[model samples]
Target chain A: MRLSIENLYHTYGKGLAFETAALKDVSFTIEEGEFVSFIGSTGCGKSTLAQHLNGLLKPDSGRVLVDGKDINEKTPEAMALRHRIGLVFQYPEYQLFEETVLKDVMFGPKNLGCSEEDALRRSRGALSLVSIDPDIFGQRSPFELSGGQKRRVAIAGVLAMEPELLILDEPTAGLDPQGHDEILDMVLALRKNPKLSIVMISHNMADVVELSDKILLLSHGELLKLGTPQEVFGDAELMARSGILPPPAASFVRRLAEKNSFFSSLSPALTTEAAAEEIAKALQGKFE
Target chain B: MENIIEVKNITFSYPESEEDAPAEPTLKDLSLDIRNGEFVAIVGPNGSGKSTLAKCLNALLLPEEGKVCVAGMDTSDEDLIWKIRSQVGMVFQNPDNQLVSSVVEDDVAFGPENLGVDPAEIRRRVDEALKAVNMYDNRRKGPHQLSGGQKQRVAIAGVLAMQSSCMIFDEPTAMLDPSGRAEIIDVICDLHRQGKTIVLITHFMEEAAKADRIVVLKDGQLAMEGTPLEVFAREDRLREMKLVLPFAIELADQLKARGIELPKDIVTEEDLMAALESLTAGRKTAGEAVPCA
Candidate 1:
């Protein structure tokens, strides 16, 4: 399904003594199967913009459209649109509550009113998708598992809903490097499904640059830049102004460009692999 | 030259819960000596006893098999536990959990007041600590109203008000963003420069690289311990322990594998940049190069 947000505006503590605008005139669109990333400094309205996608928070102005229909409409059909979009919050493992892992994973589908047999099937499928062996973990208590395992189980709970569009807010926060890679791998694997669209809010610039097809940069409740990873990371000054630097590879390339004029052609190397390749290429034809 | 904190063959295990399983030890035969005014970083994967070790340093968890001494005071001595704690103040992962008072200045003063310091002395310490963390301007603001970095600074101020000679940060930046992490790191480095010993436990390899020494743990045992240059050069051992190398080290290793002649000791970003600049200096173009789109 196509998800489009236009001219969105939101405020916190409206009419209060300490009123603050969290989002202002933010607009973006995510087509089916596209991977979009929202990045900025902390408290920069990235979460506020993501909340608008599934009607968790209604914008004070503008609209959120799912397949050209406003999701904010006060109708049963609009309310059901929430099931179409799944949001996995930061530290989602904290939301896990059940005696057994299988029971916890089944909660989403069961809450959606699916039959027991269907819920069981969906829960097993979701568990396996996240590489959790249902036979070994299904009977175990989620609280007994390791940090990474608990996180995968929590993500599986969300996946059981069969959300066509999955939104994860800092899914890998506080996880070790291995857990971080595992979560990213799960998201990438899920993107292989033709019906799935992924939107992630991330603070890790390297992960965002490596994974995102389109990146939306937000600053102080406003859209700063929305473009491909290359385009956004290429603008060093703008990213610096947002209190964030590009990934190490990109920053290295920019530094190299300043020192050696021959390196300016490859200004924004977004990944380590790309930086290595560019460095090799630049040195191969000369200086031998 | 003097050891501020010393752990001698400490072995620790958690008590069993309702879950049907054996209670395994979290720290096993771990021994470390942190020198006065030294900056040491403890790095390990999850469940490697990093946090357990931090608790042992300040007498929060006494070693079952061995002893921990802080500034010559034994932690296992019940009467000296408070003295050991005051000599080595700790800042934990969560800022919100540590901030006890609504106002920033009051929260900072709480530590000193609990220590039974004179009222005038408490005011002086609170002022100095807030200024040291660069949160003096926001001293009157409520703790919840500040940014994550600001709140963390206030938390550091609380610890600083105790007049501790050494600080132990237990993944203090784990819950913070990159900018927030930078702020905390900056504060820690400043404290280090001001002659306070620092023990930083972090999963971020880049942050660990700033330390004077690094101690790597695996399965509650000391897997590797050396300077950042020495420890990071053992890439195979670090990878086996499930710890990722810093970005510069990884990139340099990749480039080296692809026939680049970078030195083996390249761990920090500055080192990598310098190596690359020297390698590509001869190939500098004569005219201004075109900028990327």
Candidate 2:
């Protein structure tokens, strides 16, 4: 699904004493099958923006267009928009409340009025996509699964909805290093589905640098910058001012450039290999 | 200088259910000793029994076998449980789950109050603890009014109010954002500097790297234990246990692969920067042409 967000404005506790504008004039677009990452400090309305994707929160002003159709409209088409977008919350595994993994995953599809057989088929497909062996995990309660497995089961529940757009809010927040990679690999694998687009809200800048096709940077309810990883993370001063750190490689290069005039010709790099090339040049005094 | 918590051959298991065969025991014959005023980090993959080990520290769970001694008091002794608990405060992953009172100071005061400390002493401790965590200004605010970082700090403040000599944090930053995670880590580090023994159970490798010592667990057993550099040096073992090397370490390895002569001791970001700085300084003097990638 192609999502076009325009001039989004939202406020919490509107007309109350403690009213705060959580999002202000935020605008961005996410094309079909693109992996878009939203990053900012905590309480920067990343969660608020994710809710708007599925029409969970209607913007106080502005529009969220899903495939050129405004999702906030009061119509049957708008109502179905909820099913078109699946949202996986932070620590989503806590929401699992089913007797078995299969039952838990089937909940969403079943809630959408799919037949039991169809829901079971979809649940099985989703389980396999997340690399969970249905034979081993399908019969067990989600509570019995380990932390990483429980999270995957929770994600499978959403994937069973067959969303054209999947919005995840810090899906790897509490996971261990191994669990973090597992979830990330699963998300990366999901990108192979041409029909699915992903919108992720994350705080891990390294993950953003590695995975995002495009990045939307938010700072205090304002859209500070929107660009690819290289463009967003390339500007050391901007990233620093916004309270975001680029990948270590970028910072290393930036510091080296500052320390020696010879290294000034080297461009900023986001990945380890790219930075290594630059570092090797400085070591050999091969400044272009 | 002295051992504050001593776990001796502890083993624990949860009850089985009918859905499948009995699950493996959560913790195996695990033994560890946390020294006073030391910052110790326990890191492992999920189901590695890190959380189970944290629970045993303050008698939250009595080990099915063996013993846990806190500040010379045995955890299994029913009469001494309170004393052990009072000396070893605990902070959990979710700040919201641990907080009870609406007001910040009131919530912090709850711990001291429960211990039946006099109101005057409780008030003083509450103020002191809040000050320590830099939440004194928000003491009058409702718990809901604070940000996630602030709330977690308030949780730390609550623990401080109990006047515990040691603190056990169980994945305290798991639910927080990056900044919130840093806030709690800073608070704990500050507390450790103040001579309070800290046992931090975390999954983040960077956090673990900051600790004076890191303990690695694998499938409920103590797989490795040493300083951060010592434990993390075993890349093969860590990978086998499903742990990721810290980013700096990974970068250093990548650089070393490309024939960069960095010190093997480089682990933290600062270390990587210093090593690179010194290497490039040598290049400036020698004026040698390096190969470009």
Q: Cα deviation in Å at residue B175, candidate 1?
A: 1.1
Top candidate on lDDT is 1
> In candidate 1, which residue ranges exceed 4 Å CA deviation?
A259-266, B280-283, B286-293
**What is the C-alpha lDDT profile of model 2 across A1-288, one tens digit per residue?**
899999999999999999999999998889889999999888888999999998999999999998889999999998787689999998899999999999999999999999999999999999999999999899988898878889999999999999999998998887888788889899889988878899899888778887799999888999989899988998777788788767767877787677665466678888877887766755655444
Record all residue pairs in model 2 with backbone atoms less than 3 Å apart, i.e. clashing: A284-B290
Stretches of candidate 2 exceeding 4 Å from the true structure: A255-266, A286-288, B19-23, B282-293
Q: Give the DockQ (C-alpha) for candidate 2.
A: 0.46
Model 1 lDDT on a 0 to 1 scale: 0.90
**Model 2 TM-score on chain A:** 0.96
Supply candidate 2's per-residue lDDT for A179. 81
Model 2 TM-score on a 0 to 1 scale? 0.94
* Fnat of candidate 2: 0.41
Compose the digit string of candidate 2's lDDT tens values, residues B1-293: 78999999999998776656557899999999999889999998878899889999999999999999998999999999999999999999888898899999999999989989999999999999999999999999998899888998999999999899999999999888777887888898899889999999998888899899999988899999999999989999998888888878887888788777888897788888788777666344323445455
